[model samples]
Target chain A: MSATVHIADVVKHYGKVEAVKGASFDLAEGEMVALIGHNGAGKTTLMKMMLGLIRPSRGTIAVLGENPAAGEFSARRRLGYLPENVAFDAALTGRETQAFYSRLKREPVKDALALLDVVGLGHAVKRRVDTYSKGMRQRLGLAQALIGRPRVLLLDEPTTGLDPELRQTFYDVIQKLAAEGTTVLLSSHALTELEERAGRVIIMNRGLKVADGTLDELRRIARLPTRIRIKVADLPPSGSPAWLPTATPYRRINGHIVEIDAAPDEKLDLLRRATADGSAVQDLELIPPSLDELYAHFLRQAERPQ
Target chain B: MNALITIAAKEIQQAIRNRWVLAATLLLAGLALSLTFLGSAPTGTVGARALDVVIVSLSSLTIFLIPLIALLISHDAIVGDMERGTMLLLLSYPVARWQVLLGKFLGHLAVLAFATCLGYGAAAVALLITGSSFDGEGFAAFAAMIGSSVLLGAVFVAIGYLVSAVVRDRGTAAGLCIGLWLMLVLIYDMALLGLLVLDQGRNISGGVLSALLLLNPADAYRLFNLTGFANVSLFSGMAGLAASSTLSVQALLTALVLWTLVPLACATLAFSRREL
Candidate 1:
């Protein structure tokens, strides 16, 4: 597939402050790529640069082979953006707002109600935006973005106020859009939320890109230690057989709990030895690290001195 | 072109829904009606005739109402969007910045046009009912005056958009627009009068006076329309100067066009560079 978004050493600054420092990435077509970063990590700033709202201080960013800051309407015509906090004119009702955007895009107004229905806002279609709850407004925003069935969709903090069910619905819609060959770029601090939905993830910290890859690829690169917690009825003395040599073992979060991290091969050996010793291994668990841990670990590494 | 019209339609929808705007429009219309009724009453004096009264009220309103409405309508066009975070959504579309500015100006002009015609039309009907001298020329003069008022309002609509684009907040946009109105309509005219008086004894017929008139849209509009009002020959001297030296169909058209162009150009430029 062709690359839909290409950023080569893009840097953006606000006065003396560098908002996005030497950022670079490429997103292939039909990909749902999540951008994970903390607040003030330049995630929104980078998104603005991609949308051509702000010119980069240096370097190049091409969204569908066109520079955003060049005021290239051809590229924007195929693009859809959902801002972090969606706001519409309070004077207009939901349908009016949707129809306004539809008209701006030169699209038929018939699909607006359908989009609103998909976002579960069909019942309140005639209510003014000021009367909408935060989540409802976000749904309307999503509907607006989906108006023309754009080629590339940019969603910022899309799931902030959504409940689990609505969040699942949002992911389903995104997956459907991706299935139709649209490139999806999602930026949010919800790493766990994205971990399950995104085909790939790009991590940013301190105005710089820290890592980018699939979930497994990021796991391989970070090489972060896995953590397992077990519950025991009794305590073993420190530095005894209770602590496996091949693994790094630690004491309980609770008095009866023990936690350990071991290599793949040694993991079974450690569990076998614990049972073989006739010690009460009432419960055991083998846990892999999650994307949040990986993200935090990489962000720390990025902040560390070379 | 369709996109520009779409934007204008949306702006009109928004302005119509503004309660403050509706209230202000109703109040102004009421004032126009009441002034005509009072002016048609038996004056019992020489200078208090119906035509004189109608001209006084209409001209005074022209000095204040047109610019005030234009500023109120457009002073928040851009800055309000920025504050509400809606500008990002609009800019993300495939529209140009100038298209947005022009669309907004047209929208505000539509509102001003509707309000002006309604107010002045009511005044005309009230004068006719009171058995005032409602001749064809009188009606023609009133139309010309209202035409000038609308064009003048359009100039300030552009100016208000520029102020909106420059400021980051609604309050500041409003403050700047009103300040600009005060300077151009009130203080700038006064200062020009002071200068003309200071040069009263000298032979000072030059481009300096024409350039000064161009500096104030309100003054330029007054010169354009105030020439026909009797007893207003005090201003007719400056009007004559502008008409003889720099005023023509082409020059007046150019002046009106520049009134739309200059502020709109600044607004679009500012909007292009704004982070939103």
Candidate 2:
């Protein structure tokens, strides 16, 4: 599939400070990509470049096959953006705010108003935004972003104020949008949340694209250690357990809990040996490297000299 | 065109919802009515038309009050939105930056115009209903005063937007806005008076004097309303200068229009380049 958003060697500098180093990535159509990073890691800057809010100091960024920052307002119709700290006019009601954006986008108000209900804001559509709670305002922000059924969505920390249930609904809406061939680029601090939702992960560190691939692909490159937990009746003799391989490294937690670190390739081998007969291993769990570990591992690798 | 109108409508709605429209209308109407009734008391003794006296009083009032009200409503139009993070989301849509700026100017201008018309128009109506003799020239001068008053407010609103565009924070914008109002409405003439006293009309000719007054929008507005009509200029005590002044009525009106457009254009340029 063709890329819905493309960035090539794009560098953004705010005076002497380089906010986005030369970064390159292509977000495919209908693919949900997660941009995982810490604060000031250039996630917001890169998204701004794609949205045409800022131009790159070097290289180029293309959204929908056009330069977004070149002052062509019509090109942004297919684009949707939700800022990290989105705010609406406080004096206007929710419906009024939605109507205003709809008019600006040249879209019909009926469908945009319908989005208020989809985001579960039907009951308070007429209430002033100053009276709405943070989460409700977030829902209104989401509703505004969803205008025009935009084919490209760039969301920055969209789920910040959402509760667990609202987060579920948020992802559900994202899933539906993606199913309809929308390209979604989401930046958030919630690693586990994106772990289950994003089709691929792009890790940025210190204004650089550290790693970009599927979760498993990143794990294979990082070679980070997987975890293995085994529940046993005894403390596994403090150091060596007869049921486990002697060369493998492990530690005992308590009288019943023991934790083992296994290499990526050796995880299966270690699990098989521990659960050979279920005689010593009452309960067994083989945990692969999570996104959190892989994320930290790639961040550390990027910080190191080549 | 639709986007521009929609933005203007939204601003008008915000003005209504915030009670700014009501306060401005009532304030202008109350003051205009009081000026009409009280300023007309001297008409019988001074041999001036009652409506003509009202026009002069209202024009003087417009020079002081409209700019302050205009600045109060518009000093934060762009910078406040940018600081609060709404400009980011607003620009993410399919609207150009120029459209946002122009839309806001038009909206604020409409609010000012509406208040000016309804608020001051009530005074003209009251004069007609009080069983007074009326002529076409008197009513025409009253209408011109209202028109020029709205134009004066537009000038300050544009100036306010310029402040909003260039400043980094709302506090700084507010400070600069008040300073601009003081300079244009209060201090420009005061400083001109000081210069005239110092020069004693030797260095400053009548042509230079008229050009100097044209520099300040309030002066331009005052010249337009006070001198555009014959009786009003006599009552305003500028009849001799109005007759000998090189600046024509069209020239002063053009100056006021430029005062509104020049700053608005500058603000749009500054806002177009501003980073959200």
RMSD of each: 3.2, 1.5
User: What lDDT tens digits, residue by residue, belong to model 2 across residues B1-276?
Assistant: 887888888989999999999999999999999998998876787666898788889999999999999999999999999999998998888777788888888889888999999999899889889866679998888888888898899899999999999999999999999999888888999999999999998989998898899998999998888888898898899898788888888998899999999999999999888775
Query: How accurate is chain B of model 1, given as a TM-score from 0 to 1?
Result: 0.86
Write model 2 residue lDDT over A1-306, tens digit each, in one string: 999888999999998999898799888889999999999999999988887887889998889998999978666988889999899889999999999999888999999999999999999988999999989988998899899998899999999868999999889998899989999999999899899889999999989999999988988888888788889765546567776778777777766767888887888877777678457778877788889988888888887885
lDDT of 1: 0.81
Q: Which stretches of candidate 2 lie over 4 Å from their true place?
A: A232-239, A276-278
Model 2's lDDT to the true fold? Answer: 0.89
lDDT of 2 at A260: 85
Candidate fnat values, all = 0.83, 0.85
User: Considering every candidate listed, which one attains the maximal TM-score?
Assistant: 2
lDDT of 1 by residue, A1-306 (tens): 999899999888899998888788888888999998889889899888888988899999999999988977888877889999888899899999999998887778997568999988999998999999988998898999898888899999999978888888888998999989899999987788888889998988878999999988887787765666667777654443344564465655666677877555566777777777576777888777688888888988997885
Interface residue Cα RMSD of candidate 2 after superposition:
1.2
